[model samples]
Target: MSDRVRLKGRFIKKKVRDKQVKAVAAMREAHLSKNVPRSPPNLKFSFDGRRIVDMQYLSEHLKCIKCKKDIFLRNTVEESRMGLNCILNISCEECSTLTRVHTGKMHGTGENKNRVDVNTKAVLGAVHSGIGETALNKLLVCLNVPPISANLYKRYEREIGPAIEAAAKDSCREAAKEEKQLVIANVDKLCQEM
Candidate 1:
């Protein structure tokens, strides 16, 4: 064969190999995505001595404060300067009741206050404990407060709060594993090409 013809054939072969690698990489990524678990909700909380203080993902059975029907209860955690607080919203499929629970810590003064007030730190703390950073940021934006950074948010996640941190960590680990699998698959394909 002529030199030029040989060179052309070699170039076409390389192009075909490259295309195959890309196709394989794309398929591997898709497979990884399918295997990956959905990211768990970051909202997590536990209860205080007598009250359901932390409201994130809490499941309880109670009489709906509004309709008075026995229903499953769920509370969302919210954040404020003082810490986390829970906002209880009870539902029975047909009706719902909303109530706010405070952790007693107040912002600015850091003093314990009457838990009945909505703006108290205890309430804010309960709210903060329940929601993840993304939700918290959205809530803060809605309330016209500055959004907290993710690093600061992580610190808050590690600090004194609900015992639901385990679920959050498991979620993060699962995501990381999915990402790592993608990386390894791509690397293996590249090595095969060489």
Candidate 2:
């Protein structure tokens, strides 16, 4: 290996050793059953509201969709959408999923709405590509139900679309307003307590 590669590897190994020690100590303090931190890590992101959990904490909590095994996000890919820095991608051991993190409670509604939109798009794309219908058929077959055709899938979308959009919009607005009020109230309370 090149000198640079060797030096980088050594640095990473040392960092990993230090982190492992800290993690072990934290786990011991929290009781051995909990291998992760009880309190969220000190991490700040602009879009993430005050109530948002740190990425480190989230990474600790994330589980693989397939195996349901705990996984860690090793890298983050950032992207700008709606003029915010969203976590566009993350790399984990088993699989990677797209993520969008918003900072502070004030933005929770907006964040939730964004999540809904993303989920809707994902589902729609799956359906359009026949993946969702095929998967549904497989599931139905397991339950001994009749299979469905792609043409009939539009009916499902039509039935669900308006409700989903309305609910998502309402939820987003309500959440954002509520979170903003809560944060302001907390700040006031903190001042009074101090």
Candidate 1 lDDT over residue span 1-194, tens digit each: 42222243554455666777799999999988754444423446443323324343232334555556555433333333322343443323444233333333323323323222223332246455775677876776676545556765564444434445666788899999998998887997878889
**For each candidate, what TM-score against the reference?**
0.20, 0.30
RMSD per model, one decimal: 30.1, 25.0
lDDT of 1: 0.48
Worst 10 residues of 2 by lDDT: 102-111
Sum up the clashes in candidate 1: 15
The Cα local distance difference test for each model comes to 0.48, 0.48
